[model samples]
Target: MTAPTLRGAAAFVQQVRAAEQHLSGADPVMAAVIERHGPCTLGATRRDPFHTLCASIISQQLSSKAADTIQARLMAGIGAGRRITPPLLLAASHEELRGYGLSTAKARWLRALGEAAAAGTLDFRALGRLDDEAAIAVLDALPGIGRWTAEMFLMFALNRIDLFAMDDVGLRRGVAMLYNRGRPLSDARTLKITRRWAPYRTIASWYLWRVADPVNEIWV
Candidate 1:
């Protein structure tokens, strides 16, 4: 499926609202969560899933500031964002990426992503066709990509409504605090409780992340 345009996305929002209503009727948890959290922001993106996924991998395990800096360096390395193709990424030496502040593992993982894309093993165009689980399975097959990464891909790149990154520490912590629990929410427990949110789990997860941001003193 082609990426959603701004107009198309508005339509999708309407569709989601309808789905939310239906799902809410079936499951009150979903209705309540949607009422609290509203819509999940699917940012406007001209880039395809390939670029989005590549960016996400580059951002992994790094602070947002560090990720932005590395991304800028890599963009400079490629000369222009337009040249950030699979071959260019594959051709970029490990030393080159390291020079741009990438760890050895991150460079290797990026190369794997490039190689998979080049080999037709990672098809950005076909990503929309796959169900959430299948899409995640395909992504996790790559090096350096874990469930969190796959879940991020589903939530952001795929604009999947039902997906949530349960393994995210920030989300777990946020949810734990939200419900006024003394212990942090375990992944298994998060899954069980999240059943109520159903199709809007991603939106709920976003709020949870915001609520957990230490710099903002949200949890306090």
Candidate 2:
């Protein structure tokens, strides 16, 4: 697959700088974040869609380091230095997968994903062709997947250019700090504030993640 670019990031900053000079509700906090962080971009791993989705599941609510460790263990068990395949995962029993450090829920989710892939129900190729809404709808139809998981699939796996996670705690907290607020910003409020960004919200979202998570900035 061709690599995605952050051309949107640079353009959004230019637009924001121009808009803030005239607009009343432009996020000055976001402006300051761009100024401090320089230009941000999509830093997604170059993995296949299925693997990326699996990685996203592993990452849910876990620290990045912990997720990586668990994923490494699972992968090593599934395929010895080979690609992650549905057949390989299905070959392992539930207890075997759980022994690799997956919670009961995550192990079930992984099994369902593998079953879907094997049955041709979860078409990664078709998912690649889907727009943001369609992709989310398809993924979230599965058990154990929700809106946040679907959004992560869009942002990281499909590399959708126009998406953002309003519910992201890091982004909200970062926005609060950048704006000199004492409390975390609410998702509803953040969504309202991000309107000026429009189609470039994904780029803005990247900046928020970076600002909100400095220790993990290396990943951004």
Task: List, residue by residue over 73-152, the lDDT tens digit for candidate 2.
Answer: 99998873645678888999999999999999999998999899999999887777777888889999987788888887
TM-score against truth, every candidate: 0.80, 0.81
After superposition, candidate 1 runs with Cα above 4 Å error: 5-7, 16-39, 214-220
Provide backbone clash counts, one per model.
0, 0
**lDDT by residue for model 1 (66-176), tens:** 787888889789664653678878778989988888889988988888888899988877877888888888888889888888887777666676766767778778768
lDDT of 2: 0.71
Give per-residue lDDT, candidate 2, residue 45. Answer: 46
